[model samples]
Target: MNTIFLLNKTKDPTLSEWYERKINDELRALGIKDVHCKAVSSEPMALEITHPLVLICSSSILRDTYSYQSAEQVYAPHAKILAIIVHEKVKFFRHRFTNLQFSPLRFIYNPHRMPLRELIFHLLSQLDIDLEVRR
Candidate 1:
Protein backbone atom coordinates (compact mmCIF):
# COMPACT_ATOMS: atom_id res chain seq x y z
CA MET A 1 0.00 0.00 0.00
CA ASN A 2 1.25 3.49 -0.82
CA THR A 3 1.25 5.85 2.11
CA ILE A 4 0.17 9.43 1.45
CA PHE A 5 1.08 12.28 3.71
CA LEU A 6 -0.82 15.55 3.94
CA LEU A 7 1.42 18.41 5.02
CA ASN A 8 -0.05 21.84 5.67
CA LYS A 9 1.92 24.86 6.86
CA THR A 10 -1.07 27.10 7.44
CA LYS A 11 -0.79 29.08 10.67
CA ASP A 12 -4.31 28.28 11.65
CA PRO A 13 -4.79 24.98 13.43
CA THR A 14 -8.44 25.10 12.55
CA LEU A 15 -7.63 25.23 8.88
CA SER A 16 -5.26 22.34 9.32
CA GLU A 17 -7.93 20.26 11.00
CA TRP A 18 -10.45 21.18 8.37
CA TYR A 19 -8.10 20.26 5.55
CA GLU A 20 -7.26 16.90 7.12
CA ARG A 21 -10.86 15.99 7.61
CA LYS A 22 -11.90 17.18 4.19
CA ILE A 23 -9.09 15.44 2.36
CA ASN A 24 -9.34 12.21 4.30
CA ASP A 25 -13.10 12.21 4.04
CA GLU A 26 -12.97 12.64 0.31
CA LEU A 27 -10.35 9.93 0.04
CA ARG A 28 -12.68 7.58 1.83
CA ALA A 29 -15.58 8.55 -0.40
CA LEU A 30 -13.41 7.49 -3.32
CA GLY A 31 -12.71 4.17 -1.50
CA ILE A 32 -9.04 4.97 -0.87
CA LYS A 33 -7.21 3.68 2.18
CA ASP A 34 -3.69 3.97 3.60
CA VAL A 35 -3.86 7.76 3.23
CA HIS A 36 -2.97 9.90 6.22
CA CYS A 37 -1.75 13.33 7.31
CA LYS A 38 0.96 14.85 9.49
CA ALA A 39 1.10 18.63 9.90
CA VAL A 40 4.50 20.27 9.97
CA SER A 41 5.28 23.79 11.03
CA SER A 42 8.90 23.90 10.01
CA GLU A 43 11.11 23.47 7.01
CA PRO A 44 13.59 20.63 6.39
CA MET A 45 10.80 18.22 7.05
CA ALA A 46 11.43 16.85 3.61
CA LEU A 47 14.68 15.40 4.82
CA GLU A 48 12.90 13.24 7.35
CA ILE A 49 10.05 11.88 5.28
CA THR A 50 10.35 8.56 3.45
CA HIS A 51 9.17 7.73 -0.03
CA PRO A 52 5.98 5.96 -1.26
CA LEU A 53 3.96 8.58 0.64
CA VAL A 54 3.04 11.38 -1.72
CA LEU A 55 3.48 14.77 -0.06
CA ILE A 56 0.49 17.05 -0.34
CA CYS A 57 1.34 20.67 0.37
CA SER A 58 -0.98 23.57 0.99
CA SER A 59 -0.97 27.00 -0.73
CA SER A 60 0.87 28.68 2.13
CA ILE A 61 4.14 27.14 0.98
CA LEU A 62 4.25 29.51 -2.03
CA ARG A 63 4.93 32.43 0.23
CA ASP A 64 7.97 33.45 2.34
CA THR A 65 7.10 30.96 5.08
CA TYR A 66 9.09 27.79 4.51
CA SER A 67 7.99 27.69 0.87
CA TYR A 68 11.13 28.11 -1.20
CA GLN A 69 13.60 26.11 0.83
CA SER A 70 11.11 23.39 1.56
CA ALA A 71 10.28 23.12 -2.12
CA GLU A 72 13.95 23.18 -3.04
CA GLN A 73 15.04 20.50 -0.63
CA VAL A 74 12.07 18.31 -1.41
CA TYR A 75 12.85 18.70 -5.13
CA ALA A 76 15.76 16.30 -4.83
CA PRO A 77 16.62 14.14 -7.82
CA HIS A 78 14.21 11.56 -6.43
CA ALA A 79 11.68 13.60 -4.52
CA LYS A 80 8.02 13.94 -5.48
CA ILE A 81 6.03 16.96 -4.39
CA LEU A 82 2.43 17.80 -5.22
CA ALA A 83 1.35 21.36 -4.75
CA ILE A 84 -2.26 22.48 -4.50
CA ILE A 85 -2.39 26.01 -5.78
CA VAL A 86 -5.30 28.34 -6.24
CA HIS A 87 -5.67 29.65 -9.81
CA GLU A 88 -5.94 33.25 -8.71
CA LYS A 89 -2.62 32.69 -7.02
CA VAL A 90 -0.95 31.17 -10.06
CA LYS A 91 1.65 33.92 -10.04
CA PHE A 92 3.30 32.19 -7.09
CA PHE A 93 4.10 29.07 -9.12
CA ARG A 94 6.66 30.93 -11.22
CA HIS A 95 10.16 29.47 -11.06
CA ARG A 96 9.24 27.98 -7.71
CA PHE A 97 9.71 24.27 -8.21
CA THR A 98 12.14 24.29 -11.10
CA ASN A 99 15.04 22.35 -9.59
CA LEU A 100 13.20 19.10 -9.06
CA GLN A 101 15.47 16.39 -10.49
CA PHE A 102 13.07 13.42 -10.29
CA SER A 103 9.89 12.33 -11.99
CA PRO A 104 7.72 15.33 -12.77
CA LEU A 105 6.00 16.64 -9.68
CA ARG A 106 2.23 16.78 -9.73
CA PHE A 107 0.09 19.89 -9.38
CA ILE A 108 -3.66 20.51 -9.25
CA TYR A 109 -5.23 23.92 -8.90
CA ASN A 110 -8.79 24.47 -7.79
CA PRO A 111 -10.60 27.55 -6.54
CA HIS A 112 -9.36 26.45 -3.05
CA ARG A 113 -13.06 26.32 -2.34
CA MET A 114 -13.99 23.53 -4.71
CA PRO A 115 -15.72 20.44 -3.46
CA LEU A 116 -13.35 17.96 -1.85
CA ARG A 117 -14.26 15.30 -4.44
CA GLU A 118 -12.93 17.42 -7.30
CA LEU A 119 -9.54 17.84 -5.67
CA ILE A 120 -9.44 14.17 -4.67
CA PHE A 121 -10.05 12.98 -8.23
CA HIS A 122 -7.44 15.29 -9.66
CA LEU A 123 -4.92 14.06 -7.09
CA LEU A 124 -5.68 10.39 -7.61
CA SER A 125 -5.53 10.62 -11.40
CA GLN A 126 -2.09 12.18 -11.26
CA LEU A 127 -0.66 9.35 -9.16
CA ASP A 128 -1.81 7.08 -12.03
CA ILE A 129 -2.79 4.48 -9.45
CA ASP A 130 -6.29 4.76 -8.17
CA LEU A 131 -7.98 3.37 -5.02
CA GLU A 132 -8.71 0.17 -6.86
CA VAL A 133 -5.03 -0.56 -7.23
CA ARG A 134 -4.49 -0.23 -3.51
CA ARG A 135 -7.32 -2.60 -2.74
Candidate 2:
Protein backbone atom coordinates (compact mmCIF):
# COMPACT_ATOMS: atom_id res chain seq x y z
CA MET A 1 0.00 0.00 0.00
CA ASN A 2 1.13 3.57 -0.64
CA THR A 3 2.36 5.69 2.26
CA ILE A 4 1.88 9.44 2.43
CA PHE A 5 4.55 11.34 4.27
CA LEU A 6 3.50 14.96 4.70
CA LEU A 7 6.74 16.90 5.03
CA ASN A 8 7.71 20.58 5.13
CA LYS A 9 10.76 22.41 3.92
CA THR A 10 13.14 22.71 6.82
CA LYS A 11 15.65 25.55 7.31
CA ASP A 12 18.06 23.75 5.01
CA PRO A 13 16.02 22.58 2.06
CA THR A 14 18.93 20.66 0.56
CA LEU A 15 19.72 18.75 3.71
CA SER A 16 16.06 18.15 4.39
CA GLU A 17 15.46 16.77 0.92
CA TRP A 18 18.49 14.57 1.30
CA TYR A 19 17.08 13.17 4.50
CA GLU A 20 13.69 12.83 2.86
CA ARG A 21 15.33 10.97 0.01
CA LYS A 22 16.78 8.55 2.50
CA ILE A 23 13.38 8.06 4.05
CA ASN A 24 11.97 7.36 0.64
CA ASP A 25 14.76 4.88 0.12
CA GLU A 26 13.71 3.08 3.27
CA LEU A 27 10.15 3.00 1.99
CA ARG A 28 11.53 1.56 -1.20
CA ALA A 29 13.24 -1.12 0.83
CA LEU A 30 9.79 -2.01 2.05
CA GLY A 31 8.66 -2.08 -1.60
CA ILE A 32 6.53 1.00 -1.17
CA LYS A 33 7.35 3.06 -4.24
CA ASP A 34 4.15 5.03 -4.04
CA VAL A 35 5.43 7.02 -1.05
CA HIS A 36 5.09 10.79 -1.09
CA CYS A 37 6.51 13.50 1.19
CA LYS A 38 4.26 16.33 0.16
CA ALA A 39 4.39 19.91 1.33
CA VAL A 40 1.32 21.61 2.79
CA SER A 41 1.18 24.22 0.04
CA SER A 42 -0.29 21.69 -2.40
CA GLU A 43 -3.60 20.69 -0.99
CA PRO A 44 -7.35 20.64 -1.60
CA MET A 45 -6.70 17.54 -3.68
CA ALA A 46 -8.49 14.29 -3.08
CA LEU A 47 -6.87 12.61 -0.05
CA GLU A 48 -7.81 9.28 -1.53
CA ILE A 49 -5.90 10.08 -4.68
CA THR A 50 -3.20 7.72 -3.52
CA HIS A 51 -5.25 5.67 -1.09
CA PRO A 52 -2.25 5.34 1.15
CA LEU A 53 -2.13 2.65 3.80
CA VAL A 54 -0.45 4.98 6.31
CA LEU A 55 -0.19 8.72 6.97
CA ILE A 56 2.90 10.29 8.54
CA CYS A 57 3.56 13.92 9.40
CA SER A 58 5.37 16.17 11.81
CA SER A 59 3.49 17.89 14.62
CA SER A 60 4.65 21.35 13.56
CA ILE A 61 2.74 20.76 10.34
CA LEU A 62 -0.48 19.87 12.10
CA ARG A 63 -2.01 23.31 11.76
CA ASP A 64 -0.15 24.49 8.73
CA THR A 65 -1.47 21.74 6.47
CA TYR A 66 -4.97 22.10 7.76
CA SER A 67 -4.32 18.48 8.64
CA TYR A 68 -7.15 17.95 11.08
CA GLN A 69 -9.75 18.74 8.47
CA SER A 70 -7.76 17.15 5.69
CA ALA A 71 -7.34 13.87 7.50
CA GLU A 72 -10.93 13.83 8.63
CA GLN A 73 -12.08 14.27 5.07
CA VAL A 74 -9.40 12.37 3.19
CA TYR A 75 -7.73 9.61 5.16
CA ALA A 76 -9.14 6.17 4.41
CA PRO A 77 -11.22 4.57 7.11
CA HIS A 78 -8.65 1.80 7.57
CA ALA A 79 -5.43 3.71 7.16
CA LYS A 80 -3.31 4.49 10.23
CA ILE A 81 -1.66 7.84 10.96
CA LEU A 82 1.74 8.23 12.54
CA ALA A 83 2.51 11.61 14.10
CA ILE A 84 6.22 12.36 14.24
CA ILE A 85 6.74 15.33 16.51
CA VAL A 86 9.70 17.39 17.61
CA HIS A 87 10.86 17.56 21.26
CA GLU A 88 9.30 20.95 21.76
CA LYS A 89 6.02 19.95 20.16
CA VAL A 90 5.77 16.68 22.11
CA LYS A 91 4.63 17.77 25.57
CA PHE A 92 1.68 19.74 24.32
CA PHE A 93 0.70 17.30 21.58
CA ARG A 94 0.83 14.07 23.62
CA HIS A 95 -1.92 15.16 26.00
CA ARG A 96 -3.28 18.04 23.93
CA PHE A 97 -5.24 15.91 21.49
CA THR A 98 -6.48 12.42 21.97
CA ASN A 99 -7.12 11.02 18.54
CA LEU A 100 -9.06 7.78 18.49
CA GLN A 101 -8.88 7.71 14.73
CA PHE A 102 -5.28 6.88 13.88
CA SER A 103 -2.30 5.26 15.58
CA PRO A 104 0.66 7.68 15.80
CA LEU A 105 4.32 6.61 15.95
CA ARG A 106 4.79 8.67 19.16
CA PHE A 107 8.52 9.29 19.03
CA ILE A 108 10.33 11.08 21.85
CA TYR A 109 10.68 14.29 19.77
CA ASN A 110 11.83 15.44 16.37
CA PRO A 111 10.71 13.46 13.31
CA HIS A 112 14.31 13.18 12.17
CA ARG A 113 15.37 11.70 15.48
CA MET A 114 13.16 8.69 14.74
CA PRO A 115 14.94 6.11 12.65
CA LEU A 116 13.55 5.67 9.15
CA ARG A 117 13.95 1.90 9.46
CA GLU A 118 11.96 1.87 12.66
CA LEU A 119 9.26 3.91 11.00
CA ILE A 120 9.15 1.51 8.07
CA PHE A 121 9.10 -1.45 10.40
CA HIS A 122 6.17 0.07 12.24
CA LEU A 123 4.25 0.59 9.03
CA LEU A 124 5.11 -2.80 7.60
CA SER A 125 4.23 -4.64 10.77
CA GLN A 126 0.89 -2.91 10.93
CA LEU A 127 -0.07 -2.81 7.27
CA ASP A 128 1.31 -6.26 6.38
CA ILE A 129 0.70 -6.03 2.67
CA ASP A 130 2.22 -8.63 0.41
CA LEU A 131 4.53 -6.47 -1.65
CA GLU A 132 4.13 -6.99 -5.38
CA VAL A 133 7.76 -6.11 -5.96
CA ARG A 134 10.81 -7.27 -4.05
CA ARG A 135 14.05 -5.33 -4.44
* Tens digit per residue, CA lDDT, model 1, 43-133: 4664466642334444544455443354435443234555443333345456655223222334444454355566566556656764463
TM-score of 2: 0.42
Residue-pair clashes, model 1: 0
CA RMSD (A), model 2: 7.1
Estimated TM-score per prediction?
Answer: 0.53, 0.42
Regions of candidate 1 where Cα sits further than 4 Å from its true position: 41-44, 52-79, 85-108, 111-113, 131-135
Clashing pairs counted in every model: 0, 1
Candidate 2 lDDT over residue span 32-119, tens digit each = 7655443333234423344432333344544434443434343433333443323223435554442322223232224434455665
